[model samples]
Target: MRLAPGADLPVEVLERPDFPVNRGALCGKGRSAPALLARDVRLTGPLLRDRPGGPLRSAGWPEALDRVAAGLARVRAEHGPDAVGVFGGGGLTNEKAYLLGKFARVVLGTANIDYNGRFCMSSAAAAHRRAFGLDRGLPFPLADVPHTGCLILVGGNPAETMPPAIRYLRELRENGGKLIVVDPRRTRTAELADLHLQPRPGGDLALALGLLHLVIADGLVDQAFVAERTSGFERAREAAMAHWPDRVERITGVPAHRLREAAGLFGRAATGMVLTARGPEQQSKGTDTVGAWIDLCLATGKAGRPYSGYGCLTGQGNGQGGREHGQKADQLPGYRSIEDPAAREHVAAVWGVPAGSLPGPGKSAYELLDGLGRPGGVRALLLAGSNPAVSAPNAGHVTERLRALDLLVVADLVLSETARLADVVLPVTQWAEETGTTTNLEGRVILRRRAVDPPEGVRSELWVLRELAARLGVPDGFPADGFPVEAERVFDELRRASAGGDADYAGIDYARIAAEDGVFWPCPAPDHPGTPRLFLDRFATPDGRARFAAVTHRPAGEEPDAAYPLYLTTGRVLAQYQSGAQTRRVAELNSAAPGPYVELHPRLAARLGIADGEPVAVTSRRGRAVAPARVTEAIRPDTVFMPFHWAGAGRANSLTNPALDPVSRMPEFKLCAVRVEPLRSQQAGAEPAGADAGAQSAGSDTVGVDAAGSQPPGADAAGSEQAREETAA
Candidate 1:
């Protein structure tokens, strides 16, 4: 970040010129970071609603903290500790993420705790861990991308999502490397590929299997590497052989010749890599689908080699770190399993708590949200750094679950969609005004320096957690060092808890991170240099061999039927960040990508008599949403794409399916069955569906961002009036 000395706001947010990943480039989201600090919509202090369905009002720190503590205590006393749920986000710093987990278990002693990161890349993480006994977004850094001979990008559009990283793809092609892109649409990233395979939605598993079959048939399998460094290949091979090119073509809608061609390109290359994003990872069969992709890498000798492996393109800030720390549902600090007794002992010791006192893994993100306010489910929830109301799959249902909660506490920088519905909202400090550590996609731990002071009355998450813990009646100061409010103090304890663990951050300190420009993880000792490239000589498995998954293609949880004859896929746009909690409030960003629109194939649009920019109603089994049509040949004929960054009328997630991967517990957010109908009589607000989500003032604030897709007669206008009356009251 380039800021004038002592200035309240940054002059320009520039990428580090020497950084290996971004390499002197900044994406629109990165550059717009300053706009968040300047926004008037930022929540300056705590807000409380004393009763159900009551309007929130300002409260002092003491009163608000007391109310939150009392509510949580009431829930625990009435329904037991398990009823108090703690929800976190991927955007939180590692300290905050770790502290949140500690707060849930050590303070409140609840098992019902999870975070939004589960929605981002849980499937990929599961597959990676299953294959290599460890889960890192990328074993090799982004710097290895340009050097690889061939790159198969599955379900990722980094050109739009991560503009700065596109240079690697461009350089790969310039250096004569082949790029094969697999997606249901010919996205901007796909346009750059040497071969673009537009498969059917949720057909990525079949596509990967087809590619693997061809690799073996063409004698491209690395027999020597597989025999020496892998296990379970025979079963995986059998599964792939069953998925012949012709059979795979039938399922994925890709021609056999193209599958063979894509296979040949990857197989012929001396080095190769496969990277998947939400399109493949956010599915009911996402774990198996990702396993299929990893199987391809293993078959082609891509694992445990330089510039070759399977990686996940994580979509959230601190995504790698958030999951590695204690925030995830099933993990302890340093990515240790919560079910592991030894891991429990170590983390408990660090937290100064009895090992037996720690709670077991509760539920994944969607399950926790889905269980809200139900019998024997979570009654009071403390959510921080996430806006599941807009981001969750089957969002309409999730939003209502949130509303049903007896106590909803949200800590955020702005009045986010989830915050607006919060019974008690605590204004929290954001990135620029908070100092902490974040692990980037490459497993690099970087120290975040506070550039400026936060506005008065705004507290840091560290302070919030400490105060809450105190109010919850911790005898000692708490968490070893009394839950010190300083980030450095908390980090020192994190280093201890992470020692000798999978992600091993003991060697990494604030000093080391700053001096090294960010240190990669598995730095087990202070003298040991961080492992930038993992699994070079040996994989992390018990026998020093990567495991190949024996998996086969399965149909999506919900396939297109007569009632819902089309596939609905959701993704990110260039100008908006996840859930659009902060990005949508930025005027420049909102102007660039102001509204959500359904991207449909030209033929599909014509068949439905829907012109470009015409409002189209997309109805699914769960709900319905209305958005403008973007008719183009870029998308598949049987599929429609919606960017899941908006709310209200165009809230795409409302129509997404909640069918979850059994292993990863990740919802099928990317694909669901839906029907498109051209709207002729309905008209919602014209200022896009986003402005209504977190609007501050009443009457003028657009309303009716429903948990249900289709509203009743005059519900939209009536919602607006109700919002006005509430704000006035």
Candidate 2:
């Protein structure tokens, strides 16, 4: 890697190719990271808005911290400790995650603390624990994909979303392994597959059951393996049997022949794997959807063996490790349940507090945000590493709730849409400017070294937490000098805190990780080598057996109806990352992906009188957003795809459903019912259409094709109420 002085600051050049996993292959996002270092869009110092509708003024650190402390203290004094809520992001380092949890509980004494990671992999996490008694995303490394005989990728598009990972899939094909893809869109990844099964949106559960039924009917089940290493086969078999070929074909758009083909390839392989991503795991029934796929692997004897298993393609920088530690509502450090007395005691001792001092688990991500400003709800919120105002489901309504808060503090590198609405915004360090540890999809913990100094007025999250703690009457608890800002110091304490938990990292340190490329978790002793692959000899269950979930197919929480006849599915584009707070600012990335667009089949666009690059409006029961039409045959005709990376009228999340999965509490972001309308040429820019742009200048809140086509009276209000009611439950 080389660094050269560029426009605003020194830029990072090409990366070292000797690194494993990515192997020096920088995706658009990776290569463009230096682009995010621009000074113009960055929050160089703290900005404070003294009054609700007042212009934010730059302030010194002391003044800003004082105001934030006073505001939070006032809320805590008026309402209660829980009134001051804490929201984190999945991009936070392990040290930051652990410390953020500590600050919320030990300092603020609040139970309201959670992160955006809940929306990423909670469904798969729930399913993994239910069957294998643990969750680690992937049990094997990317290196193993080439050795497998077959790879079934469900609801994932890694070619565009994760470029480096596509190498493994390509290598799998090179080694004579077959690739089967299940998604509504024929993504770049699907184009590389030997077989692509484009099932209807929210129909993944049915498709998995159909494949399992074919596997069982063809006598492809590993009878001996199922009998010896697994249990509950009869119940799972009965559930899968109920989903016959004809019935499954009716529910999912996939044909019977395609199901049989996918089943044959997976079952006949000597060593195979099933990998799932957000596509099938962001619905109300996402747990069961993932469980069905896991059951197929278990029944076919593909799991718990070398080069054969089920895995999840975790998105986000540190999504895998973020959930493993304390930022989650229900989890303590090391993936331990906060409700468990033993787990609480262990963590409490590590934090130098009594077990009883710890608060019980709080609400999940969406629930936490939805409760803001409601009766008996949180009042003051401290946000870090997350921008839910644009990334959350039913985002328009979420933005409204955020505005209703008494005080909202945001810590980020840039002035994201969420930060625009904050009472105070604090500039913080990011990727190359900070040193931390992130566990990748393969569960390998690697260190990210700092390459450049953050601009003036910028600070690390650790420093901010220490300062806030002192101001909040915890000066003794967190002495500025004692509370370390160095990443290694924080990780040292984290190692002790995670000693005996499930995702243990006690014996692993910065030195060891750097020396070995990376080390896998559950590395308890100093001399003990990290476990690269799990479930080789026995499952994690008490009986050393994997349990099969008796899951059945179910419809999405919000299905297409007469009023909203087309299915709306949201995802990522090649040129942008999640939320687009950082990526959208990069000139190169923005030039390629300038704004959000509606991707619908040419037939659907033709029927709606929409042309490629023409403006179109997509409306759901909750809200509406307008973007340019991208007519293509790669996606299903009945579904419309939009990337949730932009804000204002181009924000796809504005029209997304917020129906939560009962088990994982993950909102149904993958699929929702929506109606598409072609906008007149003269009315193309009637609504906002770019990143960070404001809503319709017409000042009317409703979004529709024309003035006469506005939403029915009370519709927007009713939808907002319904969303709040659902989230409250």
Any idea what lDDT model 1 has?
0.84
**How high is each candidate's TM-score?**
0.93, 0.93
Against the true structure, candidate 2 reaches a TM-score of: 0.93
Which lDDT value does model 2 have at 681?
Answer: 39
How do the residues 417-521 of candidate 1 rate in per-residue lDDT, one tens digit apiece? 687688788888888787899998889999888867787778888888888888889745333332223788888888999998999999999988989889999
- In model 2, residue pairs whose N, Cα or C atoms come closer than 3 Å (at least 3 residues apart or on different chains), thus clashing, are none
Model 1 Cα shift for residue 681 (angstroms): 7.1
Give one digit per residue, the lDDT tens place, for model 2 in 1-729: 433213366755755578878888989888867766656546577777767876565677999899999999999999998888999988998888988998998888888999998889999999999999889989988889889999999999999899988999999999999999999999999999999999999999999999898899999999999999999999999999999998999999888988888899999999999999999999999999999999999999999999999999998988999888889989899899999999999988888888999998898989989999987888999999998978998787778788789999999987676876888888898887888899887889998878778877888888899899898987644424432246778787788888988898998999899999999987997887998899999988889999999989878998888989999999998999998877766767877888888999989988888999988878777777778899999999999999988766677888888899999999999999988897663353333322122232111222112134533221232223223222321
lDDT of the candidates, in the order given:
0.84, 0.84
Q: Each candidate: RMSD to true structure?
A: 5.6, 7.3
lDDT of 2: 0.84
Deviating ranges (above 4 Å) for candidate 1: 1-15, 475-485, 681-729
